[model samples]
Target: MRTAYSVETVRAAERSLMARLAEGALMQRAAAGLAAACAQLLRRVYGSRLVLLVGSGDNGGDALYAGARLARRGAGVTAVLLAPERTHQGGLAALRGAGGTVVPGGPESVGAAEEAIRRADLVVDGIVGIGGKGGLRPDAARLAALVGQSRAAVVAVDLPSGVEADTGEVLGPAVRADLTVTFGTHKPALLIDPAREYAGSVRLVDIGLELPGQAELEALQHADVAALLPLPQAESDKYRRGVVGIAAGSARYPGAAVLAVSGALRGGAGAVRYVGPAGEAVIARFPETLVSDTGPAKAGRVQAWVVGPGVGDDAATVAEVLGADVPVLVDADGLRLADRDTVRGRGAPTVMTPHAGEAAALLGVSREEVEGARLAAVRELAARYRATVLLKGSTTLVADAGGGPVLVNATGTPWLATAGSGDVLSGLSGSLLASGLSARDAAGAAAYLHGLAGRYAADGAPAGAHDVANAVPEAWRDVRG
Candidate 1:
């Protein structure tokens, strides 16, 4: 798993490592890594025009020292110092010794800096670090804008400047880098976000800092997903594996039942007991499904239940399933029908899957608000409902009410925004819940597998909801292998 730490945690780790190392040793290690990455990008470092946006902190020092290294290797390097007086004096002396020219930054040198930025073959953004809050200052903002206009590839130090490192919020003007070389550990902004979009591709440089405790957020890798997958044992029987009860679809939309059943069939469940109005449609598509025209209460014994995919006006069915003592997953119209108090009162675990629009409705806010601050929205929904929330979008995030790290699903395609795609996800996750995974694990694993299936189904082409559902077994095998 790829984990991300908050800025506070990273800073504390840095301090601990710095106390044990020589004064300049840590910075030297960082500068060496930065220079090496830049050198690789510039292929021919000799005669390469390099411009470093040097600020007042250690980030600026890193850039200046890196510039010095490049200059010694026969590159023409220039440093535009944003804070001349407060700049790292040692780094400044070293740059001058290595034949790097320095230019003062502010109103007077804006033109000179812009000129250098336009002419440079590469631009290094050290204007701000992870410690910066809000947005870029005026001097930095103008330079950031120029970097956008320039054809030169930009590399950000630590993180893209002007983004919240912990929250992944882009408050104002922020640097957009082709690549970001972060040291020690990954920052939250580099992994989540509106900020993550700014950090194009991230490269971590180990500064040998020891980070303790849990991460703020984590993205499951192949190995992690493989371990979480439920596999059948030699003596496993149908009932022993677990049965998933699906309360979905209505006379108005029978396809929802068919699609949900399609997903449930490949979701590692021993059997799927489906209940509701579209029993015939579900049976037609998946003949193996145990179909029932009765309510969820009459549906045979099940380890877990999936409620509401296309039950347009069937609020009674949603309420009935919520009354059950098994783990339940609520989605689509069910999110609107289920009583908030009853959901909170349930002893069994509950999982909510909502897109930005649905989540906005639950929170009484605009869709833009939820989309703009997805991290906050997911956590708030999970806490308010006292359930695990899977916020589905371009980036799927799963948050638990217990307040641990949120699991981020990074393997999805734009083609996944199909009509019945969410129904498949609901069924898949519900099946995993029935198979003995915790709500958090079930939601995270389902999202990971769903995204991979989407990728496989799409393959740069348009794919429907059934295509995604049909690809689940392939995704399952890919994970297990």
Candidate 2:
């Protein structure tokens, strides 16, 4: 699993390591890694034009030292000092000694920096550090705007300028980098959006910071998911494997039932028992499904239940499913119908899957707020309902009720913004729950598989919910390998 620590945690770790090392040794280690990464990106370093947006902190020092390294390799480097008086003296002296040109960042010197930016092949952004709260200063923002207009490939040092390292919030104007070379470990901003969108692609350059065993956030890779995947044992029968019960679909939205069942069949469940008003429609599409028009009470026994999707105004059905002594996944309309107290009182684990709009409704906020601060929103929802919360979007996040590490997944394409996508995900998550995975693991692993399946189904084109469901096995096999 890939992990990210908060700014405070990172700083503590850095201080601990710095105490053991000689003065300036840690900075030099960081500079060496940064310069090496920049050189690799440039390919041919000789005679290449580079611009460093130098500000006042250690970030500025990192840029200057890295620039000095490139200058020694014959790259023509220009340092645009945002705060000339407060700039790192050691880094400035090093750059000047290595034959780098310096441009003062004042109103009168803006044109000079603009000229260098126009001719630059790569722009290194070191305007603000992780401690930076809201946006950029006026002077730095102007330089960032200029860099945005230029054709240069921008690389940010540590965290991107003007983004919250801990919360992943971008308040105002921030530097958008083509690649960010982060030292030590990842920050929440690098993984969570809308700051994640600002941090284009990330490259971690470890500088040997001794961190705690647990991280604030984590993103599961293929190996991690593969280890958690539920496979059939030789003695396992259909009942032994676990049966998933789906309480979804309505008379008007019968397609939701078929799509949910489709996902369950492909999701490693032995059998899917679907109970809704759209039984005939579900059976017509998937004959393997044990369709029932009766409520969840008479639907035999199931290891897990997935409610909502196209249930519309069926509050009773949602309540009935919630009452069952099994792990439950609530999505779509069920998010609105389900009571908070009742859900919290449940003996078994419950997973809530909500889009931005649904999450906004649950939180009594606007959709824009949830989208803007996804990490905060998901964490809040998980705490409020005392259940595992899965907030779906361009980046899918799974937050556990107890809140150890929030799981982040960025494996799907934008084409996944299709209709009935959530329905498919609901079934998959419920199936994983039935197969004996915890709410957090089930939601995170399901999200990982679902995103990959969407990518396979789309294949650079548009795909329906059915296509995504069909691609689940392929994603499973790919992960296992």
Candidate 3:
């Protein structure tokens, strides 16, 4: 599990670690890590021009010290100091002592910085950190614009400035970095998004901050999710494992039935029973699936059920699925049609999967609001509906009804945004549920696997739903092995 602590927790941890060390020790450790990362980036590009956008805080100190390291290593290094008087004194002295030049921020400074950035092999962003509030100041904003417009690889010190370190909220404009080398533990913003989106790739730099309190947020990496995946024993048979009942697809959208069943087939379920009008189409695509035209109650001994996903706006189907005594996964059209109380009152585990748009509809908010505060949105949904909620998108988040550990799925690709992809995820998650995983684990594990399958199917090329489904077994093997 990748843990993310809140900003206050991080600060306290930093204080604890700093108190044990001599003055400048923590900063030196951070600077060394930053400098090493810069060297690696420089080696890849095969050039020596490096520019540091310095602010007035310790973040700037980190950059200036790093700049000194590069200057000593045969690289041309320069610093564009946003606050000349308030610059980190030790860092400034180190840079100047190492033959690095510090330029004031202005039109001249901007011109020089932009020119250097255009020709530079890498740019280091130190404009802001956990101490910063709101968006970038005008000068820092202008510098960020230049960095964004430049072709040089940009590495952020700590985090991309202007992003809320606590909430992953971009209050206004922010820097988009190619790599972010964060000190100590991971910040919630680095793992969640709109801030996470700005943070292209995150690398944690251990400064030995002894953080306080439990993690505010968490993400499941490959190994973490791999451990959570369901595995069967040699004595296990189809009925003995688990059976997943799929109540999806109406006559209007029969393709949803096919896609949802396809996902369940690879979801680690012992067997899948399809119930509803689209059973014919589901059977046509997956003849191995046990098909029935009966209601969810007559679907016959299912360990779990997947509801919604192209089932149209049928109130009856929603009612039947909700009334069942097993764990139910609500998705797609079911999100709009189902009753929250009925779902909650079922007394069984319930998992709701909704993309930003669908989640917005469920919460009576705008999609932008949901995207801006995805962590809060998912948590709120889980609390409100008293069910496990999975908000699917670039960064998929799974939260339990009681506000337990929230798991973020980081394996998604833009290619997985195609239609019917969500249906597959719902089926896969339902299968995990049938296989006896908790709602939160099932949802998170399914998202991780679904994303891996999507990436494998695309393989850097464009892929459709069928390609994603076809890659599921391979993805499972890769994880289980």
Cα RMSD for candidates in order: 1.3, 0.8, 1.8
> Candidate 1 vs candidate 3: which has greater lDDT?
1
RMSD of 3: 1.8
Count clashing residue pairs in model 1. 0
Q: Candidates' lDDT values, in order?
A: 0.92, 0.93, 0.89
Cα RMSD, model 1: 1.3
Worst 10 residues of 1 by lDDT: 188-197
Compared to the true structure, candidate 2 yields what TM-score?
A: 0.99
Best-performing candidate as measured by TM-score = 2
Tell me the lDDT of model 2 at 319: 98
Candidate 1 vs candidate 3: the TM-score winner is: 1
- What would the TM-scores of all predictions be? 0.97, 0.99, 0.96
lDDT of 1 at 146: 91
Candidate with more favorable, higher TM-score: 1 or 2: 2
Error of 2 at 310 (Å): 0.1
List ranges where model 1 is wrong by over 4 Å. Answer: none
- Model 3: per-residue lDDT, tens digit, 1-481? 7888887888888888888999999999999999999898778423388889999899999999999988988788889988898999999999999888878876666777778778877889998879787989888898889888888899999999999997888998889999999988888889887899899888899887777668887787778778888788999999878999998998899988889999999999999999989977888889899998878888799999999988888879888988888899999989999998898787889999999999999899999999999999999999999999999988999998887657887887999999889989999999999999999889988998999999999999999887898899988888877
By TM-score rank, best first, the candidates go: 2, 1, 3
